[model samples]
Target: MKVIDTVLNVLWLLLCGIWMALGYFLAGIVCCIFIITIPFGIASFRIAGYVLWPFGRTTVERPDAGAPSCVGNVIWLVFAGWWLVLAHIATAIALAVTIIGIPFAWANLKLIPISLMPLGREVVSTDEKFGGR
Candidate 1:
C-alpha cells in the first residue's frame, strides 16, 4: 500500500543519511536570493530530508496559511521555481518514455511544491502523522 511504503521511507530520513537529503536542500538554497524567496528557501531546507529520502519520510498536503510568503514566494516561483519545475518536467518526460520509470517519475512530480516555495509547508514522519500507527 502507498501508506505503508511511504511510512517506511520516513523512518529512513530521520537517520544519519542527511547528506543525501542535502542535495535537494542545496538546490533550494540556491534559489533563496532576495528577501521574497526566503520562505521557499526555508521550506526547501525543511523538506530536504524528505526529498533526500521520501520513502522514509512522509509528505502530507497542508493548507497554506493564506499568503504566508506571497510576494517573495511569487517572485521565487517566477525565477528559479520555474526552472526547477522545468527540469522536473523534463526528467518526468524521460522517465515516462520508459515504462520502468513511471514510479520514479510519479515520485519526482511530488517534489514540485517543495521544490518550488517550501515555506509554510511541513514535512512530517509516519509516526507523527498517525500517532505511531
Candidate 2:
C-alpha cells in the first residue's frame, strides 16, 4: 500500500500537485502579508505541503480546536476559502476529463472541505491512529 501510494503521489505531483500546491502557496503569501492573518497563512502553507504530497495522508479535526478556530474559519470562508473551493472544483473538473486523471480528480474533490474550513484541522499520516501526534 505504501508503494502504491508513493507511485500515485509521484504521478499526482507530476500531473497536478505542483500547480495546486502553488495556488495554496500564493494564497499563503498573500495571507502572510497581513500580521493579523499570519495564522491563516501558516495553515495555508501546511495545506500546501499536503497538496504537494497528498497520497498517504489525511486531514482530521483537532481535538483542541475551539471557538476561535470556528471564527477564523468563518473569516477564512468569507475571504479566501470560497476561491480555493472554486479552484479545487475547477481543477477536479479538468482532471476528470482524462481517464488517468479520475483518481486525482477525486482527490481534488476530497480537498474541498478542508480548503473551506482549514483552521480547526491538522494533516496527519494515514498510518497515525486517529490523528494522534
- Where does candidate 2 stray beyond 4 Å? 130-133
Q: Write the per-residue lDDT of candidate 2 for residues 1-133, one digit (tens) a residue.
A: 8999999999999988999899899999999999999999999999999999999899989999999999999999999899989999999999999999998999999999999999989998998945444
Error of 2 at 62 (Å): 0.9
Top TM-score: which candidate number? Answer: 2
lDDT against true structure, model 1: 0.63
Residue-wise C-alpha lDDT for candidate 1, range 32-101, written one tens digit per residue: 7747556666766666666666764566656775575556567767765677677667766766777766
Give the poorly placed runs of model 1, Cα more than 4 Å off: 1-23, 31-39, 61-66
Q: lDDT (CA) for every model shown?
A: 0.63, 0.94
TM-score of each: 0.63, 0.95
Q: RMSD of model 1, in Å?
A: 5.3
Q: Could you say which candidate leads in lDDT?
A: 2
